[model samples]
Target: LGRWINPDPGGTIDGLNLFRMVSNNPLTLRDRSGLRGSGYIYVPFLSRDTVDIAIALYTQKYAVNKKPDIVVFSSRNEQLDFYEELKKRRSDFAAAMGKSLFEKYNTSDLSRKSLLNAGVKETEIKSTIMSIGNYLAINSMTLMNQQDDEIFSEISIGDKLKIIGHGSAGSAEISSGGLKSVTLSMHELAERLDFSGLPDQALQITLLPCQSGDELLEPVFIEGKSPFMRTRPSAAESLFYEMQARGYRRVTTAGYRGFGQIRGFLESTGSHHTQRKPNSITASDDIVRRRDAKEIFC
Candidate 1:
């Protein structure tokens, strides 16, 4: 395959594959909502470059003042690997310990007092539970520090974290493997990430995925009857809500409900159902939190 230069190369996000769509493995990898084409199949959206989108975000949101603390270009393979390994570890831990105990450790505080009260030792708990940063570093494909296993053992991600990946309404799709592929749920991700070290009202997390900001209508079944009416937060919203529930306050999370795309230097502000109109530059963080036709920040 012939290589192509990205049209909008200003402040391109990462050094990996700056000019390739689907990581130049167009035959296998699936790029959804974030990119335009794979091989000869030219989709009629915007640029098929995730780097372009990330650059737009950076130019508009974080780079104006200081560079983002952590920028994660989460590839499908790495996401899948992390999800699979995390899932395996969860299952294995649950098996070794009881399901209830595992749930308590993950849900309840792992503080010394809490662990002691629960008849668990801090040393044993830490030994059994693998550090998430270590897993991410070991499995990362893009830029990641191999020594983060120790660097982030007790610390949370710094102020800002930007993740660009294939997303859906409810989860970050980790694979192009469709149903057989793994997915990381919003709640699971929120629970797994370390957020305890962030200063009050300082953490900012941005997620670029299709309809990741759209809310869901969960039917409230009553006596197994009809006319059940209820609504719930979208995946991104749930992530924020989960963070709040876990005592992280004043943290901002950004996501998009539309099929987010970029044309040249501007982000496509058009809604999901209609053709994108790139008339103005809308920064990802500046997007208004809405159910449709815009971005959501919570």
Candidate 2:
């Protein structure tokens, strides 16, 4: 699990790794009107197939303004392994998948025309188009794996939080002053930390293997639905509702997940590895937080 500031927050070309879940395009400009202020982006990695790496841009119409935050959670080693495999297969995979996607969803001509009208350089337009194709191919692959356990989960936030109460099993809460983080192990289970105290700031939350199971559990409140509640809120929804109750008006989440097995190959190829105590879960505070995409990608 990791989190970082989106170098291009609210920009159209952000969240490339999340190409699996969100279309590699900007949210409709019309929808942008309803945003009250900036929100935090949180990304979680629960399983290989359940990784949905995209930024969750939040805004409120009539609430206290707050800076956006980003959170990511995943099996670190597993995600790294999957990425290594993807890199090895990228060229072949892109070539095979790119054509079909391009033909079906290609907007190159329209995009080029728009860029030309906007006075963008020809080279930049070409580069952007190429990036679009790559993103389309990746999105196609993600759609194919929607049913697979190795795909990432889709997360969204909306106004109003409907809460009932916290469940008794596999739940924990960590609170410091008015800020709180919760871990819920139900329906695929997830861990979330709230930073209502810090406005317009970004922080990363990494969950180590040692932090898994009952040891990570703490008593916490779980929101429930009322008689009018027809749909169950997802983990993200529940967390957003909880945050709003704590006086936060905006939120966002984004990140990627692992897909293939390549860790062993990397290890054999002389990749540096870190050693940790057996079955020991590292405390959340001790986990290093990445500050930018460069650090994460490099």
Candidate 3:
């Protein structure tokens, strides 16, 4: 299932408008801006398991047509939930830590002396306290979404689909029956992905946890001759590595961004620049350029 958006007069596409336009589709439709020369093309999936299946199908379909066949799995909903949970967990942890510190050190203020007296090493206190956030973030990412089990069970071995998500490293201990699995931290993921020298085609399954909204936690994507390569690890990159290590192939991952961030990326790449003769370009053409810019960045 698919839908196409024509550029508006200004060459900019309203994502909200495109979303409204495609509401009739029964499948969950994600819009990509730069494909087919610019407004947006909706990739509709009947279910989560079909996401990779559809992408693989489209990748082959576009490759056959001699177009740049790219598939991006954007974790907008996942990331948003993560961000909200992080904030709540951080606040709760802060309160709990403060209470613990006060009970142990006889003062509410956090300080080296207080932490040390409370039997917490000064060097580790900050991280130890914030670890709750990390724990919550990982679990949130790993938890299966609605109908995930049913969908996953339906996947055939020939299609080679893998589901990537976050969970306790201990979760791997549970029987996967015949399903393959691995677990790693973000840091470990970065090191392994770089050392593995794995081919893109080999990444058939991807399970991404909710990513940190903190810019510092996000991975860096270096857009050069090879646009999709990661130059550095982000909090979410580790999940990518875990997916690879576990042995599912044909993986595609993309970062989640709000509208403002998306616009900023576009501006940085000069996508916002008006065409030489603005009047000559249709609205759809301009929207296509913006979408194309996003595709390049992704």
Candidate 4:
């Protein structure tokens, strides 16, 4: 886990002694960087059909020697589409904040002491504050549109579900489900899934659907009005907040902004669609993917 030079002090310099150290079992164990010691889960809802293409693209990208585990599930009802509503809300918030202030918080640095006081790591302060101001803007706007049972869907859990793998980090490639996908909520999956099989350590959650990084107001009432203007900017933020709120310290969540896709491939079917900001203005698929692939963590 330390400096990954040759594990053997004395051996032929063939450049692959670490793989030999793990006995070639990188599935349950990995010596690589980024998310070391953490396996990934790629869960795709079965009904979308188009999501399969995205899954294939993802599998090709991430499935090297240590292949990601795939879990196929299905949903009965078509998930609600909240993209337009959220986009409108965000645009309005941006307008209210004005372009200059919006750009400042959205892409610039925040008060270092304030972020550190909020318990952000020193190294992550700069990166973490990029969207905190956007989240704050959306959170303020969402307070006016509060309603009963607004945080979760009334629909019952879907049937014909099959869960597999024990990945410390999960990437659910949701297509139909907006934020509160009908197939499953972030809380529902975390609570229902049996993650006890994994090592007793932190877990990371990722939602791969478009606009999964947008903000949503939390549904908690106090004296007929929500006390704290709490909001979840993405599925990952929701999971991270839930984990911390429910006293699970060792969990983190991440989601992509604008349109998310696996690099270098067209994941969508022939059905034509467009967005105000498609993550990137570039025309190339790979460039769009790279630009669109910015993840907002919580």
Local distance difference test values of all predictions, in order: 0.42, 0.29, 0.32, 0.38
Evaluate residue 189 in candidate 2 and report its C-alpha lDDT on the 0 to 100 scale.
Answer: 26
lDDT string for model 2 (176-290, tens) is: 1112333333222222233212331221212211111122223444468333322332323333345455554434321111111112211222321122222325643322221
Best by TM-score: 1
User: By TM-score, how accurate is candidate 4?
Assistant: 0.39
| lDDT score at residue 251, model 4, on the 0-100 scale | 38
Positional deviation of residue 150's Cα in model 3 after best superposition, in angstroms: 2.6
| Models sorted by TM-score, best on top | 1, 4, 2, 3
Stretches of candidate 2 above 4 Å error?
Answer: 1-42, 46-48, 51-75, 97-132, 135-191, 195-237, 244-298
Q: Mind giving the per-residue lDDT tens digits that candidate 3 earns over 218-295?
A: 244575754343333433344454555556334433321111111221112244322111223344443423222221
RMSD of each: 22.5, 20.7, 20.4, 20.2
lDDT of 1 by residue, 80-193 (tens): 444454456445545666656555555655542344344443655644333321222223223322123222222222223544545655443311223344456666566555
Tens-digit lDDT string for candidate 4 (1-298):
4433545321222213333333323345433444322233234333333333333333332312233332222221211122233356557655665666555555545452344345554433333343344334333322111122221121111111112211112223233433434455566655533232222123445554555555655556689764776664565566556556556543345554555433211223221222223435665543333234445453
Which of the two candidates, 3 or 4, achieves a greater TM-score against the reference?
4
Backbone clash pairs in model 4 (N, Cα, C under 3 Å; residues 3+ apart or in different chains), count = 0
Instruction: Please state the error at residue 237 of candidate 3 in Å.
Output: 3.7
Top-lDDT structure, candidate number: 1
What are the TM-scores, per candidate, against the unseen true structure? 0.40, 0.26, 0.21, 0.39
Flag the better candidate by lDDT, 2 or 4: 4
